[model samples]
Target: MNRIINPVIPGMAPDPSIIRVDEMYYIATSTFHWNPGIQLFQSRDLANWEQIGSALNKGEINLRGTNTPAGIWAPHLSYDAASQKYWLTFSHMVNMAGREFNADSYIMWAEDIRGPWSEPVYLTSIGFDPALYHDDDGKHYVAILEWETRTGYQAPGHIVIAELDMDTGKIIGAWHRVTKGFTTRGCAEAPQLYKRNGYYYLLLAAGGTGYAHGVEIGRSKHVFGPYEPHPSGEPIITSSPQHLFSLGDPDAGHFEMYNPNSIMQKAGHGSLVETHTGEWYIAHLMSRPLGDKLLNPLGRETSIQKMQWTEDGWLQMKDGSNVAKMETEGMAGLLGAGSVSHDVFDDFDQQKPRLHFMTPYREQQEEWVNTTERPGYLRIHGQNSLFSQVNPSIMATRATSFKYELKTHVQFHADHYSETAGMGLYYDSNNWLYVHLTYSERAERMILTVLQAKLGERMEYVHHQVPVPEQQADLKLVYNEGFADISYRFEEQMEWQVLLKAIDVSYLSDEGVNGEPGEIGGFTGLFNFIGSVDAHQHDSFADFKYYCVKNE
Candidate 1:
């Protein structure tokens, strides 16, 4: 039997919500602070997946000035068979200061998966990670974590369930306080409800979203009742199978809980789906650190595990092991299926940016980024600097692999020092490595140099500056295992000259950046971006002939 690789949908696709409708399967993941929020993917064979489109591409939400891990959180996707519509429920985390975790949840429906969705219906401000369950008797219920603020209460709060009026988007009844968490490991969030064989199952993401993360389960015969925990009293799925009982710990890092033997870390936050072949699988979020340094540069990724229900009516991994695996048994008939190609080569011939391209903290409006401005080229009018949280003119894509090559040809003319255009790697507003073309007043010429930001401190590599004879240049970045090499050439036929080699960029990872007091780091992954900055006049723009990313 063929094996399905871990991370079926890789690279920054976290908090997976999987479902099956007839033959096709769909998965939706979180896209915090990245515009066009709620990344959605479709799969045919479960082993292979493709990004179809995003749900919030039409300026339905504004994320300007959003913090690192604070925009759109765990998006729940469901299909209402009776209504013949696709529904999405998500949280807009506005504040994390003082651990208040202020968030507003909303629900929206679409006639088609990729379509004009209806206006958002305000749900509640109780907590984050809200999900909707459509019952058999035509009743709709919403399950969420009622965030706790009391000094001594169980931190991160209780998983509550209540009847929801879909038409008015209001809770018709009082909230039923469910279990804080099924397992000893606390920091539970992301409650997903399911019904199987007359039992309502409450699946939760426990042990925070870190090394000790896991998927815990509970069940009840009635929708609102005293639920019973799994018999094992432990998580059914986790990266680290070691016994860890941190009942009230609200910290999400759990760095000391990192499992040394497991290749996949932070394996939790699972969503279940049953295939057309009657097989069961769980799609969860996992991460891979950089060479045991415990720094996750790619952030949390989506992985699949084959699941089996035991004789006692409990869910577990197929092999009766709680440890998540990197490769698992695939479906018998759909073993060797074709997957979507990840290599991107965009020439900007179309009217809009490609579906995969996303901007930071703002929508990709045509006024700043457009293809019609120059035929066969993408014109990006300069706006704010990369450090600005609002209105930064950067078009980026997820860095799907540790070993990949990003290349682009740019035509930019900068007369002022603050005007620059280039391509490089980015994590957030505070961390990045940029190789840009800017004018040097001292040298009286256009030059290329390297700039880096680590924990919000700026550093410039002025020694590596190379004079560009023309206004356009070919740039390339080769990344391999936490290091990057920057190279450029003036013409297409010339050999690429190295500007910098073996730059240690491991600090760009999740655990490497500095964040809030109790948080681990930023919850976002790295992105390859081509952007322009004009702090001087905001009149300069960059024309890119092509953008390509190829993984080795």
Candidate 2:
């Protein structure tokens, strides 16, 4: 049997909610502040995955000026077999200041997954990570994290359930407070309902969103009554299986729970699916850091673990270990569909942008970004600066690997000092590294310069003037681990020369550029993009011949 790699869908795909429609498996993750909301992926054998399309593509919601880590939360995807429709439930987290945690949840449905998805119907403002469960008797239920605002309650609160009307989006009854959590790992959320052998199982993510993160489960005979924890009272799955004394601590980045022996960390928030062959597997959110560091540049990614039920009916890893693995055994006799292909090369010859391409906060403006104006080149008209959440003319793809080379060829004419176009690593509007071509007032010609943002502070450090007779330049960013080498050349015939070498960009990780003390940092990982800025005027645009990402 072939082994499946962990992080089946890599790079910022977190809070995964999965469902199997026939032989095909689909996973939808939180997009946070990024536009074209929920990043979605599809797979056949639960191993090789492909990013197919986004669910919130048509401005169904407004994310303008949304803060990092505070827009779209966990997206729950499910199919109602009776209605023959697909249902998606999500939360729009609008505020976290003072930990008020004000958020509104909504639900949408469609007959097909490649959706003409219905407009979002309001669910409730009770909490975040709302999910829908379609029961056997045709009753629909909603489960969510009930935010605890009172002083004496558990910091993040309990998992609550209530009956819901699928058509009208109305809660039929008052919220029933279920278990605070299955274990002592206090910060519980992401509750999903499932049934097996006359027992109703509630799977949840516990221990917060840091080192102690884990997947725990409970079961009950009744749908909304006293649920009992698994006999062990320990998590069914976790990256750090070792006992941690800080189980009830609400603080995140419980660095104390960091398992030195494990390669994967922060493994939790999982969704389970059963295969056609009767095998059980879970697609969960997991993270990998740079080395011994807790900083995750790729953010929380999706990983799979094969599991089996015990004679007692409780779920356990197939190998009988709670620890997460980097590789797991594939289903027996199941040769998966052909490996999903990633479009790493874009020659600007296609009529539409690739599915992998994404923009920050707002939808990509077709008026500013187009390939039709210049047949062989992608024309990106300059917009707001890269730091703006408004209209930044940046098109990007997730940095899937730590060691990779991103190259792009651009022809830019900057008449003023504020106009620039180039390629570099981006995390969000407030955090990024850009090596752009701009008119250097001192050099009297187009010059290459490096701009860096550390915790929202922007700084310009190194500069080099391009040699004369050079209009179009080939730019490359070589990232090996946490160190980045940014280089450029005037002509393709010329060798790549380093403009900035061995720059320690480890600060670009999730921990480095986080929000004010209590708020979570950017959960979305690093991206490589080619964009332009027009602080002087919107008349300037850069034409790119091609963009390529090669994993080293």
Candidate 3:
């Protein structure tokens, strides 16, 4: 039998909420600052997963001008057996300035997973990470983290629960404040309710979202009451099992808690499910930092660990340890991982683009990107500059591997220097490294140039430029351990020549951006994209023949 690998879903897919309906498993994760709000994935064998669709595919909410890591937060996916419907609840965090996390939560339902979802019903703006639970007694409840803004209080406030009227999206009674947390690892959030063996269990993510992150558990006889901590008085699962000096520090990159013995870090924010065979497992968020450094370019990913219920009626890791592993036992009789591949080679021949493609800030305008107009090619009509939060003609996918190569062939005639089209690595509009084809008055032809934005500072490195005789060129970027090599070739038959080699891109991680030490940096990972820019006029377009990505 084959073994199961960690990170069932990789690259910026965080705060996973999972559910099992019969033999099939479905998960929903947060997609911050991306157009299609919540990412939904499906799997059968627990080892292989594929993206089916997004929950918020339509234009219900506007994400224009949304800041880094502050759009759609944690999304909870639950199924009601009686009603035969699937429910999804999530928070749209608008702002996080001055630690004032103002957000509005909403709920929606559908009959099928790939669904015509119901319109979003407003919940509240009290906090983030809202979840809906349907009890056997036909009652519904909502759990959230009531954010505390006043001084002299526990930093992130409490985990509260209340009866919810599903029809009206309103709370029926006063909010009942549960325990601040079961232990000293504060910043308790992402509350999930589970029932097993006559007890209502509350699972939370605590110790912030840095190196000290973990998942803790508590139980109570009643749905909303005084919950009791686990017997261990510590996190039930974590990447770092040992205690750290920075317990209450809100900093993101808590280097003190880095577990040198483990490959996974920041394991927390989990959602649990039980298989048809009565086996237990938890899908949680984990990160793999650059070798020995605090930098994480791939962002938080989704990982799974086998779980078991102890004799004392508490859930714990199957190994009786908190450290997350790279490989684990597979489901019984599951022979092979499925053939759903993450790598892409789109030749612009399909009627609809691949499911993994996503745009920034707003939804993709069909007029700007079209494949029907030009057969066998994707034409991107340039709009605003990449720095603008409004309309940037960019199509991207997650950067899934640390050692990978991305290549795209494009044809564009640049009348002025303002028009450019090519491929690059993008974190956001404000932070990216682009190698594009643009008009160069000095060279009097189409030339390749590099543009970089590091923490809001934009600069054009002129030395990494080469003149091309033809209007069509191939752009390639290779990334390895926080360093990127940019190269280009003029023709399909020509050999690739290096333009920039071993450029330090460690600053593209969450710790490198300029922001508040603890609360400010970007949480989204890197992306590989093909885009265009028309500063002079929005008429110039680029025709892309193909886009391919492969792990090196």
Candidate 4:
């Protein structure tokens, strides 16, 4: 048994879907507005996982301008035994205005793991968090959270199961609503199907995707049923379990519920898988609060808990507690897989850019991204400011730290007017900080500047213009545990002068960062963005020499 030493997939990698094919395990997470969407990970043992590539690279689905936390939702991965094809179903959440919660679901199929996947088939007009089950009768059924908006019906409605003809894109069966009572947690989503012994066990994610989130289990004697709740009378694993019938308890199933002793917080929404050796594991999305009550600074990440079957057939945590973090030793040998890998530190030595490059919005404009732009550098053109939610042409990776340094070098041959372009930190359309170089119109001197904006707020702060006698410079940002200090220097400067404004980086935390009221949460960490913004479009391009991040 191994407890997680470090959470591998951090930041906005929520609603995780995991499946083990043969000897290896693969996981896919929701990629909101980021292009080259659908992050895929591969691991040998359950403890470590590394990002491999995007499953939606073909520009398969459409997201007109869906920004953060809006593009791709919870993806359910499953393998069809009869067709021998791996299937992925997810919600392309298109709009969230007035909280109308507009979304359409689609399914993609692939035979090989590194897929030249099939075109996305428009599967349902239903709702998000869609899961697929290939029943023993060779029928394909889709389960989803039909998002509800009525005054009486609980939000996200109920978990509905229907037969979907993948070939014809139509529903064959009536929508069977499984759990409707408020205590099942009005938002029962992520319905998962498992066939064991003589029953169809459905594991569902209930409660809003918030502090109250947990996994619920119901079983039917048949594929479709008036399913009954598990016997223990509570969720199997959750942070807060129900003793009273209030909405505040963390959701869980009953058998061996709370460990009374574990350190992890609020764990639930688990997807289960059995290894080649017949032992079981649950790959679920859970979060770690930074201090106390801090929205996950890194957002919802994936964690695995070892599980085993009880004498009565209900799955129990290996330690026999409803808690989800206990380690189950010696399971790697059962899966015949190795261990998870390390973080990728790539500098693009190959012909094409490394797979980690992500453009916001669709991969539409080829002119914006090119690995061949330079020998060692990946070039992503900047079209607009940190202001526009659409077409930012920004490429970023997970911040992964409370204290870290990001630095980059750039050369700008701008027109007399197309003032600036350089590097910065990006958190969605609203928050950003860029260290750039621009020409001083009054002084006739080439100057360095820092332009930062708090939210999508229109007012920007341009730090005092300083002299940069040379053409190129290195811009650096030291994000200490809770504050950000930016500095820049010319070709051979010895000392770096800090800018006047030192932003309190803690404001970027889960609860502090500003977003739409109840609309966007701040667990998603910031990204280093090398940008080119020409408010006075006089230049053809701004060239970035290289971008690097490392600790002293």
Among these predicted structures, which one has the highest TM-score? 1
User: What would you estimate as the lDDT of candidate 4?
Assistant: 0.67
Clashes of each: 0, 0, 0, 14
Model 2, span 210-258: residue lDDT tens: 8788999999998886899988887888998876544445547766788
- Where model 3 places Cα greater than 4 Å from the true spot, the runs are 244-251, 338-340, 518-520
Candidate 4, residue 288: lDDT: 61
Candidate 1 per-residue lDDT, tens place, 254-305, comes to 8878999988999999999988999999999999998878889999999999
What TM-score, computed on C-alpha atoms, does each candidate reach? 0.98, 0.97, 0.97, 0.89
Candidate 1: TM-score?
0.98
Q: State the local distance difference test value for candidate 1.
A: 0.91
Candidate 3, residues 190-306, lDDT tens digits: the string is 999999988999999988888888999999999997899998888998888886543344335566788988889999999999987788999999988899888888888999998
Local lDDT at 220 for model 1: 96
Question: In candidate 3, which residue pairs get closer than 3 Å at backbone N, Cα or C atoms, i.e. clash?
Answer: none
Could you say which candidate leads in lDDT? Answer: 1
- Global lDDT of each model? 0.91, 0.86, 0.87, 0.67
What TM-score would candidate 3 get against the native? 0.97
What is the per-residue lDDT of model 4 for residues 192-241, given as tens digits with 9 covering 90 to 100?
Answer: 88889998888887655555557768788877777878777667766656
Angstrom error at residue 137, model 1:
0.7
